[model samples]
Target: MPPPALLYALAGIWISVIGLRSVLVEEHFFRKIVASNIFGSGVFLVLVALARRAPEGPPDPVPQGMVLTGIVVAVSATALMLALLGHLHDLEKPDNQEDPS
Candidate 1:
């Protein structure tokens, strides 16, 4: 109901749109990962803000903690995924037998 909540909702909407654009218009590996990350972050932020808006009584620390944990886990997962992809890419190096030009 606050200004910040409205801002978070708007940001979430924009981020979802950007992610959809990347999936619809981009065909690059990097773009896919970047878009996925943005989407994930936006969803988490919206959930966190919603949790923050819960009734004042007792307050829900669970959601707050979950969002924090999700953030760390998501970043680590992204790094591992990218690293693995890079390793696979290195293995697919162009052979001297043929030119990609």
Candidate 2:
């Protein structure tokens, strides 16, 4: 029966640690990209949890705005990385196959 804030904070920290490990241990570019995204999400989760601590005050816009911006950036970066991976794969495929002509 931990408090909701403690639970959220712990979860965020756990996710961040996992993400950091994946980024460090994995050699693949795709895996690194995903790990980075996970790390960013963990940061957002922690921030939201902090915001919840001050329920008396009006909700803060700064944290919300930061999280929103982060999400947009992360999505864009992932899309770009995926596109690059696809292009690289396509280029490598021709080299692996024997010429049929």
After superposition on all C-alphas, the RMSD of every candidate to the true structure, in Å, is 5.0, 4.2
lDDT of 2 at 94: 61
TM-score of each: 0.71, 0.79
Question: What is model 2's C-alpha RMSD?
Answer: 4.2
- lDDT (10s digit) by residue, model 2, range 81-100: 88998788788796775679
lDDT of 2: 0.84
Clashes of 1: 0
Runs of candidate 2 exceeding 4 Å displacement: 95-101
| lDDT for position 88 in model 2 | 86
All candidates' lDDT scores? 0.75, 0.84
